[model samples]
Target: MADKEATVYVVDLGASMGDCHNGRDESDLDFGMRYVWDKISTTVAASRKTWTLGFVGLNTDETNNTQDEEGLEGYHNISTLQEIGPMTMTELRELHPKVKPCEAYSGDALSAIVVAITMIEEFTKKLKFKRRIILVTNGESPIDDEDDSITDVAEKLNEHNIELVIIGVDFDDPEYGFKEEDKSRAKRQNEETLRKLVEACENGVFGTMQQAVEELSIPRIKPVRPFKAYDGPLTLGDPNKYESAISINVERYFKTKRATPPSATTVVVNPDRGYTQSQAFDDGDVEMGGTEFSNVKHMRKYKVNDPSAPGGKLDVPYEELAKGYLYGRTVVPFSDSDMAITKYETTKSFTIIGFIPFDSYSPFLNMGETGLIAAKKFDEKSEIGLSALIHALHELESYAVARYVQKDGAQVQILLLKPNPGIEDEYECLYDVPLPFAEDVRSYQFPPLDKVLTVSGNVLKEHRLLPNQDLKEAMSDFVDAMDLSGFDVDEDGNPVDYAPIDEVYNPVIHRLNQAIRTRAVHPDGEIGPPPEILLRFSKPPEKLIKKARPDIEALIDAAELKKVPEKAKGRFKEAVKPLSGLDIDAILGQKKRTVISPENAIPEFKQALATAEDDETVEKAVKQMGEIIRKLITNSFADVFYPRAAENLRVLREELIGLDLPLLYNKFLRALKKSLLSGELNGDRREMWFKYIIGGQLGLVTKEESEMSDVTEEDAKAFVKK
Candidate 1:
């Protein structure tokens, strides 16, 4: 379970704060709200019920706090827009328009803090919670500190263990190096009073708003509570069968996992629904509110082609469709009765299959999420047994291979368990990671790097493909100089490991979360560039690169390395060149296109084919057409380019038919089928094959359609079956 947190943000929305300050483009109210919104939106994104937030607007048009109801003098024009409770996008949206600056600027900043303190104390009475009060203001409003009793509020904050943070706009901060020139006398008095209030508290922070906003760019790593994935006895053998068999109760918890960005929900605009009139501006982007949105609905219907039906497609009941399993390019129907025959039923179990020396296992075999298998806590017997096994394995320097079934009928998983010993009397554990099966592991053979083999099968050690002694030595020196193992120094003046595993955060995960939180409040605002910390390891240390300069120069000289320009891509680059480096097309008096643009690809292809004088020219034209089709499929945003590609194939079919070159069309269609189904063209474009090719009658040409074609009608039909 996570700890309880109660935070109240008191924002000063005084009339004076409505104007721009510190030579900034935006109003003072908006500047301070940036820091507030960031913190509040983070809490909302967490969506934890224990994490509660409250908002108090100072110098608002209305007075609606507990103190005001009690006829308090200094609490005028201050309103509690939000009560201390669980916050969500709905709550965040509701609070947005209510926090705007009002014309009246009579509210006291000290009174707002006291109200926030009172709210936290009353709501969290007799409850253990991390209480915090954040005050964001421009320090423009007057403070009635003499009558408000700053000492009393400070003591109340300390008594409840509430941390108070006071951030001011352009207020003098030596550490932050920020000060507003020619500050007003009233603003100085207010800043001094707030500083004294923060000083009186045990847990308090006082800083300029600019300093707080700067720290917002630093991504905060969220700590997650580990949940037990598996809780059962880890057995070496069946304990019931033999008394010698060992069984230890243990719990499996995730140690490390790949964090993924939050997926977006599908939505549609529905004007009928009620909306909120809210517009938060930043950099001229006004998030035009009142645009109602609703979840998009999916309506799926199954049908088969039927000429008898009005639409030529018969609507079939979804329940009538049966699941199928693919068997060698065939979909074998799998009925409910036959399902049990194929399922490899398994019961929940975790047992060691065998043990191997730790050195025998390779890290490359690790497949997915790493986990910890710790003995169940508060069980001395299980802990002792687990400790004994761990110590024995550690001394032997061995790891255990275990078969695990999470639940009944679940698929089995192979796990590699390494022992981790704890201090005396502490619980011992084993680190575990999933291991790939023999079938899951793929092996590919590559050509030898040390030597090259000629066409006559003679090995050559002095080939250019293999690095020579001087080149290899220079490369080794460069690699050694660029090492980052001890490049970073610790705070204590000791050499610490650079870019440690724990310190290197996943940039994609943090960057996405940061954007989501920022956009949640700003909506249409710009999310600034990636944080400096996230980009820290983007490049190697400059000092090391400088140190490796000599080695790099030596390697380049020894290897004779030169910058190679990017060669022309696609089939068009296959233009023939003679030994004299003369373009063959130019010599032959033919205009050869180096590339084809998408806009006029078909026209250029037709023109090339029309001017083709020989088989080589014709083949080149066909290859260019193929390249255009492949690019259209690969670079498509959705299926936008699919229609264009289909049109090109249709035109090519007619051209091939007119020229009686059925083989060319048949060969390209076969290759297209292979690439499409094999996911080489980006995704499973089977729909394109069915809708555009097969359904559009763009399949292999048969003798019925062209007498020059040798394709049988049955074979041509079967070729496009799937």
Candidate 2:
């Protein structure tokens, strides 16, 4: 199988396809394009230049195919939506809106296949590229097969080893259990024609449109070659000094790695291109202006706050700035020339420092990814030496702790290598996991749950805090009933495990990929809910939970666990009642107002804290001010109350800074930022953050602004972007 591929996707877009069929709400064209979009999006995601893709719109309103350009008698109503080349996000955007139903009612499906074949042929040019042509249609359009065109096309496809896939909408398929009751005569004839063509071709697939569309949800795993991370020696002990010490050349390769989803980037879209010329411009369609977008670039510059400057900030060039390390509220500056002295430079090496009993090495201590340390391939001497070392370690039931530096200037790591003995044909190897350094490890001690220590330091097992036998038994029963193992059944009705390791996929990665592809294909269509399998294990099975209700109820009663009343959702505010009924203000001989009226919030907030003598009074006043800001943001229209809210935040920040309580101000700002970003207030109020918090210079307080603050200058400057 070739890694590089040249695929041409032919989508039928005739007039009849525009009308919904077979009781389906969506048109035939829309239904068929779902499969096309999935395939195209997959190629785009691969991001390989060699794996090129071209899209041809069959029965389109225009004719712009390669065959038509060569003065062909047929191949009319065929337009090339995308050229035969590497697929990019730009190409995907351009091709998306173009794959729609055309006004042209009839076209030659055979002619479309010929056009696709010509595209792949011209692009691949007898190269070793895996060529493919996918045809998705309702088969309603007339395909002119009046001559050797069909035979000639099938022969060409076979000669090039091109894989042809034909999918027909509302077509009968006994294997798929799908048969249309009232299929059109023209469509049936075209379907048979396609089936015969597929039969003539060496590599071809003929299936119903429903069958192809149903399989689109299955994820396609990308093929990858195992890359050697480190090719060096796996040394044990000091081989130079001790003759009995082990030294064998080895190679390290990743056994497993966590897969991450494609990241989103911010770009500037040009509306002048094909977008926003009219009164009704869709903001969601960034490509409404013809899919033109410019990559966003970031520029960095250091600035120092200066009251004397016009903007209250003085810009400093990069050349003048010196790197500084924070040291106990002080910046220890270092110039570029002096930076080398601060670095701990070392050469590449992998040496076993010591050995420890396997029992002493806790698996929980493993911090990073695991990889394989195998003897250098095809080196008999190294292989034999490594095999002997592995056998010794396996016999001793021990693990070797090694210091491994992959390459010069690479990260130095502490690795725990466990030996694995091999059978007759299998090669012996060592499985290694990165270990944490002494400074990275943290230890905590807590009182035992089975017993409690009293004020006199005497342990008691039957105390109120300890769990009773009934509670323990009930909890055990509840846990057992909720277990997922054996929840699914096999072919013989045997209880099998649910969500096996290979079957379970990371929902976040696949869900996001699915969303991106869906939006690219159908920008206006409501995204289908996440696949059922992805969310199957998210919660306990309903049946199991229902069956264990008694145990759950008994456990809850035995433990006396009651739902704690939530405190107004943490940062969101509401009126608070003092349970003691003792007015602190009255006791201090000044009855401060408990609330800041939304209308006169600023002055009332100042008044509420004017007579404050303790942290509690100041905190209450700040909370009142915060509540007013939140209310203004929520209740007002658009940015009508934004300036007012910003003003409230400004006042609170200044007061906290002046009062030497930066922690209080920083905590509130973080919560406010989170709320604004998550659209909790209304539809992502990031504009408020950009305009007021960052632009108005009301970010986290740096140590320069407040002596008690721990925030560095760089952190304060970057907080707004985050």
Model 2 residue runs over 4 Å out of place are 61-76, 103-106, 143-155, 174-176, 184-193, 196-202, 239-243, 269-317, 325-331, 336-338, 422-428, 521-528, 563-722
Cα lDDT tens digits, model 1, 542-655, are: 888888889889989998976655544322333334556787667789675545566898878876765555778777778888888989888877788889999999998988
Best-fitting candidate, scored by lDDT: 1
The prediction achieving the highest TM-score against the true structure is 1
| Tens digits of lDDT, candidate 2, 293-321 | 55566799889999998799999999999
Backbone clash numbers for all candidates listed: 0, 3
Query: What residue pairs are clashing in model 1?
Result: none
Query: What TM-score does model 1 achieve against the real structure?
Result: 0.76
Q: What are the Cα lDDT values of the candidates? A: 0.85, 0.82
Compute the lDDT of residue 63 as modeled in candidate 1. 88
